[model samples]
Each structure stands twice: as structure tokens, then as C-alpha cells.
Target: MIAPTLHTERLTLRPLALSDFEPLAEFYASDRSQYVGGPKAADQAWRTLACEIGHWTLRGYGRFGVDETSTGKFVGMVGPWFPDAWPEPELGWDLMNGFEGRGFATEAGLATREYAYKTLGWKTAISLVADGNTGSAKVAERMGATWESKLNHHIFGDVNIYRHLNSEAV
Candidate 1:
């Protein structure tokens, strides 16, 4: 099924498209790379986008484009990413450098969590934040996620686990 578009007061969360590769590549190519696993060549970025599309096809949902409501420009990405051998569902996000410090990540993340719990019927969600990513940790906290455990997130290296149980928090 085509995933429904999600709206926030200042942003829109929608399924990513192939057309997003360029802007996404540019977004990644610029700053904000550190927060998103570093930069990639344009070709590699396209391949990554293709893989993300495939992930959505196989898993039913994946990261959606976070766009500005008024401008419709891609600001970044946010959604669920299931890592290999991961013990639980993970909420992930990376906002463009320009969008940082504007509460976009927090707003988009909360919306994604709501969609996961209410629309997708997820009872719980987890966020694995890199130890140095204080901003993300703050967002997780704002989403009612508590620090659960520390784990070595294979893809992102060392991380702090944060948990949010829909029933208890919402």
C-alpha cells in the first residue's frame, strides 16, 4: 500500500521518491553528514536511496522525506530503520544542517512515533542515538523515551538505547 502522507504543524512527512536522490544527495554532500553516517558520493547516495526504497517495499515502511510545509523542500529524513540483528524497532532521523536547531527533528520524530503506534500498531519503539549526538538524545527524551540500555549499534557504532512504550507514554 502507498503510505499515507503525514502532516505536522510545520512539515510534511511523505514517502521518498527516486526524484529525492538529488536533493538528498546534496543534503548529504553538504554538512549534516556526521549525523547521518557521513557523506557519500552522488552515485552511492542514489544507490542508498534505491536500497531505502527496497527496504520500504520489503518492510512495509521506512524513512519518509521530511519537507517544509510552506516550501515543500526536502529538509531531511525520519522514520524506522531496522538494523540487522537489532533487538528492537528503531526510530531514526537526520535533518539537513539548515533545519537543525529549529525543532524539525523533534516534531517529525514525534509524528513518526504516532504513526507507528496508531497507524502501524507498534506497541513500542526504540531510538539508538550515538553517544555524541546530544540533539537526538534530547529529541528522544521529548518523545517520552527513556534511556533503556547501552548497546553497540553495529551500523552506527556505540549508541545509547532509548525506549518509548506507546501504552505508557501516550
Candidate 2:
């Protein structure tokens, strides 16, 4: 199941693609990616992007490449994600370095949460935010999520799990 393009007020959440590699690689190269398992080599970024693509085929839902509607510039990635190790479907979001402080994450997060519930038939969702990533925590809060528990991830260590609104709320 390919990810369908979703639209927000100022952004277009399209399917992730091989073409997204360069910009995603550039984003991952910066120190800003530390919280999301980045500051990695371009090859690592390639694998990450490839994994996102594979996610759609395996799960029928995955991250969307967020593009600014007016300029068509790739601004970030946001949507539902659930790897096998996850406790539940996740309303994940990540805005590019320059696109922060503009409410893009909040906007995209809300849209993705709605999609997760109404379209995907998910009863609940979570945002696995790395501890100390206050920005993402705030975004989750803005999307009507609240801290549920701490998850001990082998590689990322402890992460804050934010439970999103139940499907009934949608």
C-alpha cells in the first residue's frame, strides 16, 4: 500500500521516495539529527530513507515527505509509523532544520494523528520522543498527546512515549 499524499494548510505530505535522499542526507549530516539517530554518513542516510520506503510496503503506512506547498521544498517528514518493536502505531514528525519555529511540526502532527485514527483505523497512537527532545515533546503535546511512559530502547536508550488521542476523539 503506497502512502497517499496528504495536505495541510501550508504543506504537502507526499510519499517518501529515492529522490528524497539528497536532502534527507544533508539533514542527517548535521548535528541537529542527533536526537533521531543521525549525524550519520550519507550511506547511513540512504539506508534510513530506504527503510522508510520499505515501511510503506510492509505496513501499509509510513512517513510522508513534508514539502512546503508554495515552494515545493522538502521541509520534513511526518506521519504514522510502526516498526515491529514499537508498542503501537506512532504519530511521528520531524521538520527540517530551517523549517522549525514555524508550527510546521504541529500542523503536520495533527494531520497525521487524524489520518492514523480515521483512515488507518488505529485505536491509539504514540510518539516515541527521545528524552531531552523538548521540541518534539511539545509537538506531541500540541497534537493532543501526553506522556505515557518511558521506553528503554537498546540503541537510543530511554525515550519518552507520548500517547495520542484515542480514535474516538477523531
Worst 10 residues of 1 by lDDT: 30-39
Q: Work out the TM-score per prediction.
A: 0.90, 0.96
Candidate whose TM-score is highest: 2
lDDT (tens digit, per residue) of candidate 2 on 1-170: 78888998998988987878888898899988988998999999999998888999998899899999999988888988988878777888777779988899999888888887788888988899999999999888888888999999877789999988798875
TM-score, candidate 2, is 0.96
Model 2, residue 144: displacement in angstroms? 1.1
Compose the digit string of candidate 1's lDDT tens values, residues 33-109.
76566677888778878877677877788888889999988888898777568778888888766777888888999
Candidate 1 TM-score over all chains jointly: 0.90
**Alpha carbon deviation, residue 99, candidate 1 (Å):** 0.6
Cα-lDDT of candidate 2: 0.87
Number of the predicted model whose lDDT against the real structure is largest: 2
